[model samples]
Target: MSREAAEYALRARADERDRISGDLLDLESHTTYQVLKGASLRGSTEQRWTATQESLTTLWQLNDAYRAVLRRAEQIRASRARPGAEQLAALTELLAGSSVILRAAAKPVERRSLIPQTDLRLTLDEAVTRMNAAFREVTSALNDIDAVWNRVLPRLDGADADLSKIHDLESELGETAGLTAEESELARLRTAAVEDPLGATVEPHLDRLTRLLASSRAELDLAITVKREFAARRENLVAALDLVRAAESEARLAHGAVVVKIALPPQAQPRSRVGALAGELDALDVSADPWVLRAKRLARLEDDARKAAEQARTTAKALYGLIGRRDELRGRLGACEAMAARKGLAEDPAVSESFARAHALLWNAPCDLTKAAAAVENYQRAIHGGK
Candidate 1:
């Protein structure tokens, strides 16, 4: 190379070396790299991190050698106001020749022989290439481990906090019956996350534990409320039972009226569980039973009582509907008779007979609604001038 070309090359390489040195400082001081360096990793993270450390060591050694070459070139240039041919030649060799020596003495036991080991040497450009590859390897490993810790560790902390809340609720309620499995699961997840986060599956387990904790809190709250307010709740349930009894009595009276006034009425709905529910409520040994058990029992009893009252009210409405139909037929029959009188068919034998049968069927006790409906139609036809 010519003198002028060597001078330009030396200046470019020196600048590149400075940039690489700044990048190395940034990598060493990175937060994730620091965390991985101090962490005791296992599994995939351990294997990858071990390889990355080897690459990082080699990268630093390469940088040192690169700096040495630039330093030699700078010294040669600074030696004279205008370097001669020999100085330029030496500068070209340092900037562009095989000037960086890479130590390769470490070898496997099987690869060792009696021959002396030789160091591998490369030019400044080749040294930078090798260092770039090593830097990439180290950065990729740090990022991978950082991603796993970022994704799993925060979730583990959140799960631990939830478990603490559940324990507090259990203490407040003075119960310790159902959380053993959850506690064991939480411990296992935390251990795996800390020791082998690279391979741990934490989200699904955390979600399930969250749901279980919510259910446990709800149950604990229910038990506490039942313990504190059982008296007021029992009173409300008793009043519901009284309403059921009232509906049952009203249904029975309507059924009797329908039986006397209408023919072929449907049978009355059977008495519901009001008596059984009242007995169950009275038999509840609140002082003896656990609040959880009492809560379940009270819930069942209240539901049953509410259903019984609704059924009785429905039955009463249906029975009264049958009596209302009979009254409706009577009114229609009377209106047909008045229309017959207006048309001068009141004296007609066939019209009078039809009106009589319809009136008797409608006004008489145990009224046959089907026959009364047919008779009313006949009377109406007669009033419309049908023979």
Candidate 2:
């Protein structure tokens, strides 16, 4: 071999040794130390012994190969004077060392089944899977952060203006003055709703989003807990989703029941004719006849029922109006959630900041949605309420 060839072979072997050593270190950190310690303990499985022995053997072989390569490279460096012969000798030694190390490294690849069959295997496997999921979630969260900084922050140049307008409205409506506890609370709630349509709008779809975020965080925490507690058991995403769906279904059923009650007509009973007759018979008035007076009371009751029915109709109309307003509020809340999702700000820094601002506005000592709405409406009413 030429000097150039000898140098190339030496460099290749050195590179390969470094790469393999790094991989070995990583594997050692992950598994080898634990296995060796487990093997030394009483009542340890035979599989642990086998795996440890195999790993140690591989480690020795690779170390020997690395040392041999270093020795050959040193010899080559020293024999530069005797060109061709020295080069050939050094090249041969380098090739032999490289071949040994490659073969030793190949052993692990060939004996893939050397992984221990033990109770701890399942646990370790589950830990690995959970680690992978956590890595992915972290990556996704990072991406979301990037998106918020890149896309959402730029759009918030008008936030200060909006805030100023909100303040002005508050001041104009005397919301900033000393007020009743309830009034202050309403003002706070309204400011929050206006500032962070995403976080504070809990009436419609935004409420669902808020709930979803909470649910997701809870699930992530639960998944981590389960992974640690039941390491041997695999957690399925489908199962988690099923649990959420079940809870949502139950909630919807309950809500629907409430809605049904709201929609149902109130029950009213007519006076009992038999009871009236009995009372009249007990009186037993032969001259004036108590029955005649009973008939007049029955006529009066019929008139009262008719009047009540009319009032009920009016009550139903008023309830329908309130329902419409409630639906509108729900729709607005939904729009806010959808907007946040579209902007990818539901869990990002910008959204979090917005939520904080909203909380400050709404949750200050007392919370009041009505006063805040009035404050906001006063300004809008002055500018565009007529329109």
Leading candidate by lDDT: 1
Ten consecutive residues with minimal summed lDDT in candidate 2? 119-128
- Segments of candidate 2 deviating more than 4 angstroms: 30-53, 96-387
Segments in model 1 whose C-alpha atoms lie over 4 Å from true places: 1-23, 77-84, 105-117, 243-271, 283-290, 296-387
What lDDT score belongs to each candidate, Candidate 1 first?
A: 0.82, 0.42
How well does each candidate superpose onto the true structure, as a TM-score?
0.69, 0.25
lDDT per residue (tens digit) for residues 1-387 in model 2: 667776676677567557656655664564323433443322222333344455455445445545565675657666676557756765665564233332413335556566643322122123323334543443343343334334433323233333444445434432331224423444444444433322343244333433443443333344344334432221232233334344434434433443442332333212223334334333432324232233344334434434444444444445445345444534544455456666665676545554444434333322234443343333232232233
lDDT (10s digit) by residue, model 1, range 1-387:
787898799779978988998899999899988877788778766787889998998998999888988888899899998999899889878887999998775778998988878887999989999999999999887777678778877877777777787677678767763788888998888777766666777778878887887777677778788878888998999899999999888887877767877775345545667778888987885346766677788888888888898988898888788788888888888788787788888999988898889988888888888898998988898888775
